[model samples]
Structure formats: C-alpha cells, structure tokens
Target: MGIRNKLDISAYFVVGPENTKGRPVAPIIRDAVDAGFTCVQIRSKTASARQLIELTGQASEVIAKTGKSDIVTLLVNDRLDVVLAAKKQGIKVDGIHVGQTDIPVDVCREYLGPDAVVGLSARTHELFEYIKNADVSLIDYFGAGPVHETTTKPDSGLDVDGKRITRSIEEITTLSRLSSIPVVVGGGVKLADIPSLARTGVAGFFVVSAISEADDPGHEAANLVKTWNSHKR
Candidate 1:
C-alpha cells in the first residue's frame, strides 16, 4: 500500500446519534454534509452485522452523492468481517476502529492490508501507558476519550464532560510528540468545545451527538468545521 491509495481522512462525523435517540439519521447526515463536513463516520451500536451492512450501504450512496473527500467509515469494535464486507462493495470506507477487546492491529492489517487505516481506542492513563509501550509498527491513529459520561457508550471512562477532552489532549499531545501517527479525540466533543480540543493538538475528533442531535445539523456542522479549522491553525 502506498500514500497515493491512502486517504487523509480527518474530520467531524455525525454518526448514529439520531437513530439511537429515536430520531431520523439520514436527514441529519445530509444536513451535516451540506453544512460543510467533509467526512462523516458511519457508526451504529445495537445493530447486527447484517443491519450494519445495509446501513453502511445506504450511507455510502448518500455520502457519494455529496462529493465529500475523506469518507472514513469505521466499525465501532474490531469487526474485520464487517469492514471487509463494506469494502467489498466498493464503499468509500477508509478505516476500522477497534476497542480494547478487539483484535490486535497486526491481524487487522493482515486482513485489510497496510493501506486501510486501523484506529485503536484508548481511554485511561493506564491504556495510554500500554499504547506507549507497544510496537508502533501495528497502529495508525489513536481514538482517545469518551471525554465525558455519554449515554452512547456506558462503559466509557471519565464521567465528567469536557474534562476528558483535557486528558485526551494531554495524552494525545504526548503520544503525537513521540509517535509518527496522529491521535483522534472522540466522545462528547460538542461544537462549542472543539476549539479548546484543537488547541490541545489532537489530530481530529469522532463526534456523534453534537452533529446528530444539533438543532440545525448543517449550521452545527459548519460551526464545527469552522471552529476546528481556526483553532488547529
């Protein structure tokens, strides 16, 4: 795999929050993309593998029609089968995210190859220690933080909102300084809070509720993009 085949997939994503909260998701995704989100991660918990495949297929069409660049769709857990299924359909998915219990990075890469990205979730300081000690050959980017007590994933660490961002920022800053890859901060990253997080030198974020539940997803997405852009620079 080479750089030419790889995608620079770093952006705000509105994923699954609408349907998870009993609201429609398609319109929200459409609005979010219209609002200026270049990429949106398609993540849905509680759905079976079959259901997820169908959902990703539908989402693939919507995103393809919009002409956004980095459509880095990811599976929540380390489900290589699902990722392969989605990729087999020629979908624009560029990455797959794995949790603590998911398969290790080497196996995922062997199945998906070196080109497709693999995102590892790291929440606690102890987990950060492990990531720091592990061989950097397997991983690509780090998805750090629930950054808050979110109803989305109950098992997540740190119940305090915004504070997780601080911890994730501190960790990712240190990790980024040491590693060649980037670190992405996920969980409870509100549109209003992106600026603070960007200042922490996080590579990007994985957001669901903020864009999925915003009053105006389009404007909310525009705000998220504009804010992150200004802050990152």
Candidate 2:
C-alpha cells in the first residue's frame, strides 16, 4: 500500500541449528514468542521439503496459539517452492526471506503471488543494485550485512570479526535511508552493539546464531528486542 511502515526493531529470529547442539527450532521459536520476539523466519538449508513443511506446521500452531500476527514468518534460505507450498497450505506465516542464490524476486512474485512478504539479502552494493528493479515491488525488506565476519555463514561475502559490524551498519543504514524499502542488519550482531546499530537508522535486523545458539536464546531474544526498542525512543 503506502510506503511500508518502519520495520520492528525488536528481535527477529533466524532458525538454523548451525550445528551447535542448540535447542530445536520449534521450542526455540516458542521461547522466542515467550520472550517477546516480534518476528521469526526459518532459515534452514539442510532440511528437505517434507521436513520444512513439518517444522513450519508446528511453528504455525505456535504463532496461532499465541495470536502473534506477523510474529512468525517462514523463510526458506533459498527455496521458493517450499515457501509457496507453505503459503498454499494456509500456513500462517508473515512471509518468506530469500538471498542471491534463490529465485529472482520477480519469478518469486509470479509464483508466490503478490502479497508475499519477500526479503532479499545483499552483501555488496552491486548485489543490492542487482535487485533494484526487483525491489520496486517484488521485495518487501532487505538484509544487508554480516557487518562483521561471522562463523554463521563463513563463505558469504560479508562478515568481519566484529570489526566490520560498525562499518556494515554504516553501509546498510546509508542504503536504508536512500531507499524506500526497509533495510535490516544481520551477521555478527552482539548484545552490546544493538544501540550503536539502532543509531545507524536501518529499520531492524535479522539475528541468526546470536539468538539461536545463545545460552538462553529466548532471553537473548528479549535483550536484543529491548535494546533495539530503547534506541528507538
């Protein structure tokens, strides 16, 4: 409709085990809800279609039981069909998040249909520009950073060992200010850095390992949300 509203600065969870023996995705999500996390996206790459459907089904229930509209968004790391199937099943999720390797935003829109809250990740400005035409309508929000090197996605372009977090924030904030779409920061975000990140002016963030693999993911989720909100006021 009108310019999309500013994104929620509260915690947004990304569901990937990251091989850390962390809590299962379902319970972690349940706890995320309990901890006041406003949004979630399942970002697993290893799970098959059947597995994802099963997982999202459980997540759907959690979202419904809690009455968390837009609280849970089912995002496939790079799978569009999974996203479409999740939608067709009437699985209640906010939307799907995708990245460079996934289907083009236009094709995703054609198949997933309008109204799907599609997100794209951009590590470099060129990659961001790659989706400029796509961003016109096909994309809803953009994830732009690992702001620092992260073990989370070691091979991806962005990620500096906590060193780049500020620079990444600077870059994405600049992008978000100029563009109409919301830009979110991800990768190597830490509890102490949330306020500085907020000062950058991006709408919000997508936290993966920081929340998922934390000693207390739910509590960690809450802290990030709290920190982000404090910065807003």
Candidate 3:
C-alpha cells in the first residue's frame, strides 16, 4: 500500500524558518514529531530553492532519528521544484502540498508519481465548487480552513469581497461529509478547539503557529495530540 493509505495525520505540523522565529526548522520538526505530531509540512515564503532543499534534508534526517519515519509523512509546501530536487538528492521527502494557485495537482501527481502523497488547499467558500468540478482523482487529501482568523498567512480565508472568513463547526462538518478524500483543517486551531474540531469528523488538525511559535513546541504538540486522541471520531 502507498503511504497515504496508512498515513497518520492526526496532528499535522507545518513549519519553516519563517514560522520558527529564527530557529532552524529541523530541530523544531524533530521536537514536534517526538511529541506525537504525525505529519510535517516544510513551508517558506522567502527561502530560496537551494535553502529549502537543505532544510528538507535536515528535517528528513531528524525525523528518521525518531524511528517513526514510516508513519510520519514529510511534505514540502507549494514548491514542486524543491520537492523534485530534494528527491533527486536522495532526501526522504514524501510529497508536496499546493494551494489553489500553485502548481496544478495533476502535474504534481505526474511528476511525483503514484506513491507520493499530494495534498491540495481548499478554502471554505470553494468547497461546493471543488466538490462539483475539482479533479480530485490525483489528490490524497484536502486541507480546508483557518478555523478561526489567522495572521500566519494573512491572505488566506478571505472572501471575494476581501473580507476575512472563518470556518464554523457546522461548515467544517459539512466539508468533511462532502469531500471525497480525507479533509484536514487548520489556521488558528489550538488545544481547546481540538475536541469540537475532532468531533466534526474531519480527518486531522493541522497547525502552524500553535506549535512553531509556542514557548515549548514539543509540550504544546503533545497536548494537541493528546486532546485529539481523546476526542477524535
């Protein structure tokens, strides 16, 4: 079976130097995985491709040291070229996560091949349209929502009118019901929100600042995982 069939994304950690407040991305990733984060996404708006490849190599190594790399899927955010380059250099990157405007999912799947896990970013309002017309045959999962408003990616969750939008519990439940692939939610999610969000029937809870900017990322990640395990459907 491919990794997607058995991937454990219950506590998905998204991180990069940009989110780490000047700390190296690899150590924070190591801490999160050790604390029970099941998946990791390497994301950066400013890092060059070469820099990202190096970071990916570091993260891959740290995750390996934890001895749970089989269950821990590693993905690079929005940079298909970086993913390809990292793979070419023998780094253990699993796949790529792309937004609506980034590289198309079909092309990503084509290059990365069938064994890779490809994720797509789907916004709240676009769920219906995505359900109707999105070619999800190539996708492994849909990441939907800033469950609350967030500044991590300021342009995200905005409406056509440029107003900030957030996903309500009801909306999230509906999304889970309608999506063909597994759905994971993020953006402003925290420990307290885990019980309710987990009960919404979504597959996982993803986070950026919750773990990356925490005073103790490992402890915070453990708590988040603990909360999800206790309440997840």
Best-fitting candidate, measured by lDDT? 3
Candidate 1 vs candidate 2, TM-score winner: 2
Query: Which window of 10 residues has the lowest lDDT sum in candidate 3?
Result: 123-132
Q: What TM-score, computed on C-alpha atoms, does each candidate reach?
A: 0.82, 0.84, 0.97
Highest TM-score: give the candidate number: 3
List the candidate 3 regions with Cα displacement exceeding 4 Å.
none
Clashing pairs in 2: 147-164, 148-159, 148-160, 149-159, 149-160, 149-161
Clashing pairs in 1: none
CA lDDT of 124 in candidate 2? 55
Error of 2 at 188 (Å): 1.4
RMSD of every prediction = 3.8, 3.8, 1.1
Q: For residues 143-202, write the lDDT of model 2, one tens digit per residue.
A: 777666777776555333432333455566667666677677777778887888888777
Error in Å for residue 54 of model 2? 1.0
Tell how far residue 122 is off in model 3, in angstroms: 1.9
Tens-digit lDDT track for model 3 on 130-201? Answer: 865787889988898988888788887987788888889998898888888788999899888999999999
- lDDT score for residue 59 of model 1: 67
